[model samples]
Target chain A: MIKLTYRDAVRRALADALRADENVIFFGEDVAEAGGVFKVTPGLYEEFGGERVMDTPISEEAFIGAALGAAITGMRPVAELMFADFVPVAMDQIANQIAKYRYMSGGQFIVPLTIRAAQGAGAGFGTQHSQCVESWLLNIPGIKIVVPGTVKDMYGLLRTAIDDNNPVIVLEHKVLYNYAEEIDEAELTHVPLGKAAVRRVGKDITVVATQLMMHRSLDAAERLAGEGIDCEVIDLRTMIPLDEETILESIAKTGRLVIVEEAPHAGGWGADIAALAADKGIYWLDAPVKRVNMGGALIAYSPPLEDEVVPNVSRIADAIRAVMRA
Target chain B: MTQNGIALPAQMRQDMLKKMLEIRAAEERIQGLFLENLVRGTTHLCIGQEACSVGVAAVLQPGDTMTCTYRGHGHALAMGMTMKALMAEMMGKASGACKGKGGSMHMTDASIGLLGANAIVGAQLPIAVGAALTSRLKKTGNITVTFFGEGAANIGAFHESLNLAAIWKLPVLFICENNLYGEYSVWSKTTPVRDIAVRASSYGIPGIVVDGQDAECVYHEVSAMAERARRGEGPALIELKTYRFRGHSRTDQAPYRPKGELEEWLKRDPILILKERMIADGQLDETEFEELRESIDRQVVEVVEWAKTEPYPPVEALYEDIYYEG
Candidate 1:
C-alpha cells in the first residue's frame, strides 16, 4: 500500500491511461510543460513527450472542441478546462457539440474522450475561478459527468472515465486536491459509474452529497454519531447516471433524507436529489427532504464570506439534526 | 489548376460537374420541400456554395475526415452522404441520416469521413483540428478539413482553432466558404476586416483566397495545401470567396442582399461556370448538361417519394442513442 493525495491519484490515473493506450492524448492550457495552472498535470509532458502531451493556447472552445474532433476520429483525448468556471466560454462545444454528437449523429460516432476540470471553491479562487458549474453541464444529455471525492475515487473513476466510450466530464474538486489516503496498487481498479458509495452506515437519516460535500457530510456523520443522530452518508460518484437505487434504498431504510451539496440550493444537483426522493421515496420519508446548500450567492474572496456560503460539516450536521427532529 | 499546375482530365472535370449538379439539384428539391411544408423546423441551403463543397471534397482522400456548419448539404452530398438519407432526414423519416433525430442542421455520416455538421457557428473548427491531431498522433498521412462561413471568422473558436492547429503542426485545412452573409446580416456588417484569410496570418500559417465560383480553382488551392498538410507542414486557411444564391434559411427571402448582387453571383454560378467551361471545351453539349441535371432531379424526386412513405422513429427511439453502451 502507498499513500497518495487526490491530486496524485488523478495524475497517476492519467499517466496510466496514456501508457495503456497509444490512442490516448492529453492537452489543455499550461497542461504540458507548465504542469497545469493548479500543478495537477506535471511531468506528463516530459514522460509522454510533446506529441502526446500537448499545451494549448487559452481557447476553451477550441481545445474542448478539439477533444470532440479527436475523439470521433478514434483518439482518446483528455482535455482539461483548467477551471470549471470557464465552462461558459466553451459552453457551445460542451453542451451543443460534444454532448449531442452521438445522439444527433444517429450513433454514427462514438466519442471516446474525457474532459477533466478543476472545480468547486475553498481555495479562494474568487468567483470566476472557483465555481461549481455542474448544473450547466448536467442539463445537457449525451454526456456523462463524474465527480470523484476521495483519493481512491479520484484514481478509480478517472481510469473508468478515460476508457468510457462517451464524452465524460471528470470534475476534480479544488478543495480535495491535497486529501490523502493509503491505497494498494491493486485498489486502483476501474470504478463503475452510477454507483453511490456508502461512506457511513446508519438508520436515522440518509445524508447524500458529492465531491467536497461528501467529505464534509462524512465529517458531519462522525460528529452527529455522538449525539445519537446515526446518519448514513452516501457519496454520489457519477451525477448523470445517478444511482437512484442507492439513494432511494438508503432513504427507505432511514425514513428521512438530507442532501448536502457544494452548490446553490435552487436548481442545483441537491434539488434534483430532493425531487427524486419526493417523486419516488415520498412514502418512506418521515419528514420533508432537507437541502444544505451554499444558496444562490456567488462565493466571495474572503474566507469567512466563502465559508458562509459553502456547505460545511456544521451546516450538514445542523441539517441532519433538523431532519431528525422532523 | 493554375496555381498547382495540375492537369485535369475532361472526365474528372465532368465528374466534378456531376457532383456539383447533384448538390444543386438536391438543394433545389429541398427548397421545394420546405415550401410544401414537408421539411421539419428550419433548413439552410448551400445553393451558390456548391463549388466550395465540390472543390474541398475533391481534394480530400477517401480516409480523410471533414466537418461542416449547419449549411452543409452541399458538403455532405459532396463528401458522399446519400441524397436519400439527407432527404429522409429533412422530412423527419426514421431512415434519415441521423434517424430523424437531427434535421437539416446536423447531417452526419462517419463511414464517409464526415464527422457531423454543426448548428452553432464556428463549432466545427476545433473538432477538425482535433481530427488533424488524431492523424498526427496515429502517424496517418491523411488530412482533415473543416468548412465554415465568413461570419465564423469573427468568433473566438475560429481564432483558437487556427492557433492550436498551427502550433501543433497538425494536418488540417480550414475551409472558409465566404457565402457573403451570416444568416440575415451581410458579411461586411459583422466582420471588421475584408478578407477572412488574413486572420490566418496571426498564427503564422499560410492563408490563401480562391475564386469560390470556380470549382477547378478551389480544387487547385485546397489540393496544394492538403498535400503539404499531409506532409506535416502544419495547417492552412483557404477562403473560398463564394456567395449563397438563396436566403440563409428557407424562411428568409434574402431581402438583405445588395441590389444586383444576386444577379452578379448567379452570372458566375459554380455549376454554370463548370458547364460553360466544359461546353466551351466541347466536353459536353447543352443537351448533355440538361440530361445530367434531369437525372439528378429524377433521383431527388424518387428519394422524397420514398422518404414520405418511411415512418417516423418509434417512441422508444427518444430514449435510445443518448449514450453508447460499452
Candidate 2:
C-alpha cells in the first residue's frame, strides 16, 4: 500500500496507460509543457515526449471533436477540457457526434475516448470556471460518466476508462486535486466503472452523493453518527448505467433517502435518483426522498456567496435529518 | 479532358462521370420518393454539388477517410457506399448503412472509411482532424477529408480545427463547398470574406479557391492538397465555388435565392459540363454518355424498389448498439 494525491494518481494512471498502449495519446490546452492548469498531467510531456502528450491551442471544440475522430479511426485519446463549465462550447461534438456515432454507425465504430475535466465550485474560479455540469451529460447515450472521489478511484477509474471501448467522461472535482489518501496498489490497478461503493453502513437515512459531494456526505455521516443518527453513504462512481441496484437496495434497507449534488436542484442527477426510487422503490420508502443541491442561480465569484450556492456538509446533514424525521 | 495541365486516363475520366451521374440520379429519385411520402423524416440533397464530392473522393486511397455535411448523398456515393445500403437507409430499413438508425442525414459506412455525414454545420471539421492525428501518430500514411459549406467556415470549429491541424501538423484536408447559400441566408450576409480559403492564411497553411462546377479543377486542387497532407506537410483548406440547385431541405422552396441565378448555375451544371467535355475530347461518344446515365437511373430505380420491401429494425435493436457490449 502507498499514499498518493488525487492529482498524482491521475497523472500516474495516464502515464501508465500511455506506456501500456502506444495508441493512447493525451491532447488538450497547456497539457504538454504547462502540464495542465491543475497539474494533473505533470511530467507527462517530458516522460512521453510531445507526440504522445500534445499541447493544443485553446480550441475546445476542435480538440474535443478531433479526439472523437481519432477514437473512431484507431487511437485512444484522453482530452482534457480544463473546466467542466466550458463543455457547452463543444456540446455539438459531445452530444451529437461522440454520443451518437456508435449507434448511428450501426456498431461499425467504437469510440475508445476519455474526456477529463475539473468540476465543482469551491475554488472561487467564478461562474465560468466553477460549476458541476455532469447532469448535462447524464442524458447523453453511448457515453459513460465517472466521478472518482478517492485517490484509489481516481487511478483505477481512469485506467479502466482508457481501456473501455466507448466514450467516457471523467469529472474530477477542482478541490480534490490536493486531497490524498492511502491506496492499495492492487486496488489502484483496476476499479471497474458502474459500481457503487458503500462508504458507511447504517439503519437510518441513506445518503447518495458523487464527486465532491461524496466526501462532504461522508463527513456529514460521521457527524451524524455522533448524534446517535446513523447514515449510510454510497459514492455513485458512475452516473450513466448508474448502480441503481445498490441505491435501491440501500433505500429498501433505510426506507429513507437524501440525495446530495453540486448542480442545481432542478434537472440535476439527484432528480434522476429521486425518480428511480419513486418509480420502483415507492413501497420501500417511508418518507419522500429529499434532494440537497445548489439553488438555481449563477455561481458568484465572492467566496461566501459561492460557498452559500454550493452544497456543503451541513446542508447534507440537514437533508438527512429532514428525511429521517419525516 | 485535361486536369492540372495533364490528360487524365480514359478509365479514370469515365469513372468520374459515372460516379457523378449516379449521385445525380439517386438524388432525383430521393426527391420523388420524398414527394410521395415514402421516405420518413427529412433529407438534404446534394443535387448540384456532385463535382466537389467526386473530385475530392477521386484522390482518396483505400485507407483514407472522409466526413461530410447533411447534403452527403454525392459524397457517400463517391466514396463507394453501395446504392442498395444508402437507399435502404433513406427509407429507414434494417439493411441500411446505419441499420435504419441514422436515416438520411447520418449516413455512414466504416468499412469504406466514410466516418459519418453529420447534420450539424461544421461539426465534422475536428473529427477529420482527429483522424489525421491518428494517421500521424501511428505512421499509417492515411489522410482524412471533411466537407462543409461556406457558413460552417465562419464557425468557431472551423477556425479552431484549422489552427490545431496546422500547429500539430496533422494530415487532414478541409474542403469547403461554398454553394453561396446557408439555408435561406446568402453567403455575403453571413461571411465577412468573399473567399473562405483566405481564412486559412491565418493558420499558416496553404489555401486555394477552385471552380466547384469544374470537376477537373476541383480534382486537381484537392489531389495536390491531399498529397501534401500525406507527406506530413500539415493540413490545407480548399474552397470550392459552387451552387446548390435544390432547396436546403425537403420543405424549402428556395424563394430566398436571387432570380435568374438558378438558371445561370444550371447552365454550368457539373454533370453536364463533364459529359460535354468528355464527348468533345472524343473520350466518350454522346450515345455512350446517354447509355451511362440510363444504366445509373436503372440501378437507382431498382435500389428504391428493393428498399421499399425491406423491413424496419426490430424493437430490440433500439436497446442495442448504444455501447460496445464486449
Candidate 3:
C-alpha cells in the first residue's frame, strides 16, 4: 500500500508511460523544468531528458494541434493546458480537428493522444483560471473525457488515457491535486473508460458525481448515513462515452437520483444525466432528478463569493434530501 | 520544360501537366455533380490554385506527409489520392475515402501520407508541426508540408506553429496559398501585411514568396525548403501568390470580388501557364496536350459514374470507428 497525492499519482502515471513507451512524449507551458503549475508533472523532464519532456511557448492551439498531428504519425503525446478555461482559445483544434479526425479519416488514423487540463474553482483562481468547462467539451464527438476523483483513479485513468488509440481529455480538478489517498499497488490496474465506480452502495437514493464533486458527494453521503439516509454514490469516471448502463442500473435500484457537478447548471453534463434518467428511467424513478451544480455566474476570486457559486458538500446533501422528499 | 529556373525532363514536365489536368477535370465534374444535387454537402473547389498543390506536393518523398485546408482537392489529387475514392467521398458513398463520414472537405488517404484535409482555416498548421516533431523524435528523416490560404495567416495558430517549429527545429514546410480572397473577403481586408510570408521573420525563420501560378516555381521553392527541413535545418514558410477561380463554396458565386479581378487571374491560370510553358519548350505539342486533357477527362467521367452508383454507409456504422479497439 502506498499513499500519494493526486498530483504525484498523475506524475507517476506519466513517468510510467514514458518509461514504458519511447513513442510517448510530454509537453506544455512550464511542464518541463518547472514541472507543471500544479506540480502534476514534476521530475518528468529530468528523468526523460529534453527530447521527451518539453516546455512549449504558451501556445495552446499550436501545441494541442501538434499533439494530434504527432498522434496520427506514430507518436503518443500527452499535452497539457494549464487550465480548462483556456480551451476556448484552442476550441477549433479540439472540437473540429482532434475530435473529428478519426471518424473523418475513415479510421485511417488513430489519435493516441491525451490532453491533460486542470479544472474546477475551489482555489479562487478567478473566472479565467477557475472555470470548470468540461460541459463545453461534452458535445464534441470522437473524443473521450475522463475525470478522476481519487488518487488511484488519477493514476489508473491517466495510464488508460495514454493507452487509448483516440484523443482523450483528462479534466483534473485543481482542488484535488493536493488531496491524498491510500492506493494498493497490487490492486492498481488499468481502469477501463466508459465505466462508473460505485463509491458507496445504498438503497434510499442515487447520487452521481464527477471529479471534485465526487469526493464532496461521498463526504455528504457519509454524513447522511448517520441520519438513516443511505445514499448510493456513483463516480462518473469518463464523461463522453458516459457509463449510462451503470447510472441507469443505480437509478433502477435506488428509485431516486441526484447529480452533483462543478460546471454551471445550464446545459451541463448534469442536465444530460438528468435527461437520461428522465427519458429512459422515468418509470423507475421515485422523484424528479435533482442537479447540484454551480450557478450561472463567472467564478470569483474571493473564497466566500466563489463558495456561493460552486457546489459543496452541504449543497450535495441538501439536494439529496430534496430529491428524496420529492 | 524550364520555367522560373526550374528545368525538368520532358517526361516529368508532361506528368506535372497531366496531374494538373486531372485536378481541373475532376473539379469540373464535381461542380456539375453538385449542381445536379448528386453531392450531399457543399464543396470548396481549388480550380485556380492547382499549381500550389502540385508544386509543393511534388517535392515530397513517399514517407513525407501533408495536410491542407477545405479547398484541398488540388492538394489531395497532387498527393496521389485516387479520383474514384475522392468522388465517392464527395457523394457520401460507403466506399469513399472516409467511409462517407468526412464528405468533401475532410477527404484523406493515409497510405500516401495525405493527412486528412481540415475544414477549419488554419487548424492543420500545428498538426503538421507535430508530425515534424514525431520525425525528429523517432529520427525518421521524414518531413511534413501543411497548406493554408492567405486568411489562415491571420490565425493565432500560424504564429504559434511557426514559433514552435523554429525553436524546436522540426522538419516542416509551411505552404501558404495566397489565393487573393478568403471566402468572399479580399486578403488585404483581413491582414495588415501585404505579404504573408514576411510574417515568418517574427519566428526567425526563412520565408520566400513564389509565383503560385507557375508550378515549376512552386516546385523549386518547396523543394529547396524540403531539403533544408530534411537536413535538420528547421521550418520555413513559402507564400504562393495564387488565385481561386471559383467561389468559396458550391452555393456562392463570389459577388464580393471586384470587376475584372477574376478575368485578370484567369489569364494566369496555373494549368494554362504550365501547358504554355511545356509547348514553348517543345516538350509537348498542342495536339499532345489536348490528347492528355481528353484522357484525364475520360478517366474522371468513369470515376464519377462509378461513385454515383456506390452505396451509402450502413446506419450501424454510426456507432463504430469512434475509438480503436486494438
Candidate 4:
C-alpha cells in the first residue's frame, strides 16, 4: 500500500484515466500550467503534452460545453470547474444539454463526461468562493453525484466516475484534498457510485456525514468514545443514488441518528437523509433525527464568524450527544 | 437585380425555388398546427426566413454537421429532418426525433449530422467549434456549421468560438442569420455594431455578408466557406440578413418590430422571389412549379399521417437512455 494524499489520489486517477484511454482528455482553467488550483492535476500536463491536457481560456461555458461535445464524438473529457460555486454559470449546459442528452435522444447518445469541482467551506474564502451547493446538483435526475471523503475513496470513486457512461459530477471537498491515507497504486480501484462505507462502528448512535464532514464526524466519534458514548460513523461517498440501505441498516442498529453536513441547514444533504429516515425508518428510531449543518446565510469573511457558520468536530459530537439524549 | 433574365442553370434555379417553397409551405403549416394547439410547447417559427436555410444548407455535404438556434425548424427540415418526424416532434409524439422530449427548441438527428437546435442564445457556438475540432482531429474532412442570430454575434461565446476556430484553423463555418431581432427584441438596440459580420475581422478571418432573401447568394457563400473549411484553410463568419414573419414564441406580441419593417421585408419574400426568378430565367414555367409544390404537399401530408399512427414509447424508456451500461 502506498500513502497518498486525497489530492494525489485524484491526480493518479486522472493520470490512470489518461493512460488507459487514448480518448480521455483533461481541460480547465489553469489546469495545464498551474497543475490545477488544488494541485490535483500536478505534473499531468508535462506527461500528457498540451493536446491532451489542455489549458483553456477562462471561459467556463466553452470548456464545459466542449467537454460535452467531445464526449458525444468519442472523447471522454474530465473538466474541472475550479470551484463548485462557479457551476451555476455553466448550469444550462449541464442541466439542459449534458444531463438530458441520452434520455432525450432515446439512448442515441452517451454523455460520458465527468466534471470535477472543488466544494465546501475552508481557507477563509468568502461567499463567492466557498460554498457546498451539491444539493442543487442532486436535484438533477440523470447525472450522478459522487463525493469522496478520503484519499482511497477519492481514488476509487474518481476511476469509476471516469469510466461511467453517464455524466458524473465528482465534487471534491477543498478541505479534504490534503488529507492523507493508504491507497493502492498498481491498478484502478472501482468504488461504486451509490454506496456508503462505515468509517467506524459503534452502538449508541449512527452519525451519517458526507465529504469533509465525514472526517469531522470520525474525529468526533473518537472524542465521544472517551465519554463512554459509542458513535457509529457512516461516510456517504456518493450523495444522489444514496446508499440508503447502509444508512438504514446502521439506523436500525443504533435507533438514534445524527446527520452532519457543511452546507446550510435548510436544504442540505442532511435534510434528504433525514426525510428518507423519517418516511421509511421512523418506527425503528429510538430518538428523533438530529442534524448538524452550516448556518442559513453565506459563510462570513471573518475567521470567527466563518468558524461558527461551518460545522466542525465539536458541533458534530454535540449533535450526536443531543440525539443520544433525545 | 440584372440577373433576373441571366443564364443560370435550369436545374440549379429550379432546385432553389423548390426548396424555398418547401420551407415556406412547411412552416406555414407549422404555424397553423401551433395555433390550433396541435403542436406541443413554445414554437419559434422561421416563417419569413426560408432563404437562409435553403441557401446555407444547399452548401453542406451529407456528412457535414449543423448546430442550430431556437428558431430552427427551417434548418432542420432543410437539412433533411423529415416533415412528419418534425411535425410529430412539434406535437410531442414518441415518433418524434427526440422522442418528443426536446419539443420545439431542441431537435437532434445525428444520423443526418444535425447536431442539435439549442434554445439558449449563443450556447451552440462553442459546441459547433468542438465538433469542428473533432472533425479536424479525426481527419474527417467535414466542416461544422453553426447558425445563430445577430444577438448571438454579440455574446462572449461567439467571439470565443470564432477566435478559437480561426486560431486552430479548424473546419467551422459560422452562419450568423441576422434576422435583426432576438425573440421579441431588436438586436440593433442591444448591440453597438451596425454590421454583425464586421467582428469576424477581429479574429483574422473573412466576414462575408449575403442576401438572406436570396437562396443562390446564400448557397454560394456557404459553399465557398465550407470548401475552405474542408481544405483545412480555417473558418469564416457569414452573415445572412434575414427576417422572422411571426412572434418569437407563442406568448410574444412582437411589439419590438415596426409594422413598416415587416411590410418592407414582405415585399422581398424569399419564396416568391425564387419562383419569379425561376420563371423569368427559363428554369420552369408556372405550371411545372405549381405541380412540384403539390407533390411536396402530398408528401408532407403522408408523413404526418404516418406519425399520428405510430405508437407512444413505453414507460420503461424513461429509465433506459440516461446512460450507456453494458
TM-scores of chain A across the candidates, in order, are 0.99, 0.98, 0.98, 0.97
lDDT of 3 by residue, B61-179 (tens): 98899989888888899999999889999998999989988988997999999998998888899999999999999888899999999999988888999999999999999999898
lDDT of 1 by residue, A1-326 (tens): 89999999989999999999999999989999999888999999999999889888888989999999889998999999999998899898888988889999888889899989999999988989888878778889889999999899999999999999998999999989999998788888899989989998999999998888888888889898899889998999899889999999999999999988788767898888988999999999999888888777889999999989898888888888988898
Q: Show pairs that collide, candidate 2.
A: none
Query: For candidate 3, what is the TM-score?
Result: 0.96
Q: What class would a CAPRI assessor give candidate 4's docking? A: medium
- Cα error, candidate 2, residue B83 (Å): 0.6
lDDT of 2 at B120: 89
Model 2 Cα lDDT, one tens digit per residue, B1-326: 22465556778889899999999999999999988898878888888899999989999999999999999988999999999999999988999999999988988999999999998899999999999898998898999999999989878989999999999898999999999999889999998888998998999998898889888888888888888998999999999999999988888989998899999999999989888888878998888888989998998999899899999999999998999986
Name the candidate, 1 or 3, with the larger DockQ value: 1
**How do these models rank on DockQ, best leading?**
2, 1, 3, 4
Could you tell me the fnat of model 4? 0.45
- Encode model 1's per-residue lDDT on B94-191: one tens digit a residue: 99999999999999999999998888888999999989988988888999999999988888889999998988898999999988788898888888
Mark the regions of model 1 whose C-alpha exceeds 4 Å error after superposition. B1-7
lDDT (Cα atoms) of all candidates against the true structure? 0.90, 0.91, 0.90, 0.83
Selected candidate, larger lDDT, 1 vs 4? 1
lDDT of 4 by residue, A161-206 (tens): 9999888999998988888876456644879888999999998899
Off by over 4 Å in 4: A186-188, B1-12, B163-169, B251-256, B315-320
In angstroms, give how far residue B154 of model 2 lies from its true place.
Answer: 1.4
lDDT of 3 at B183: 81
The reply for model 2, stretches above 4 Å from the true place, is B1-3
Measure candidate 2: CA RMSD: 1.6
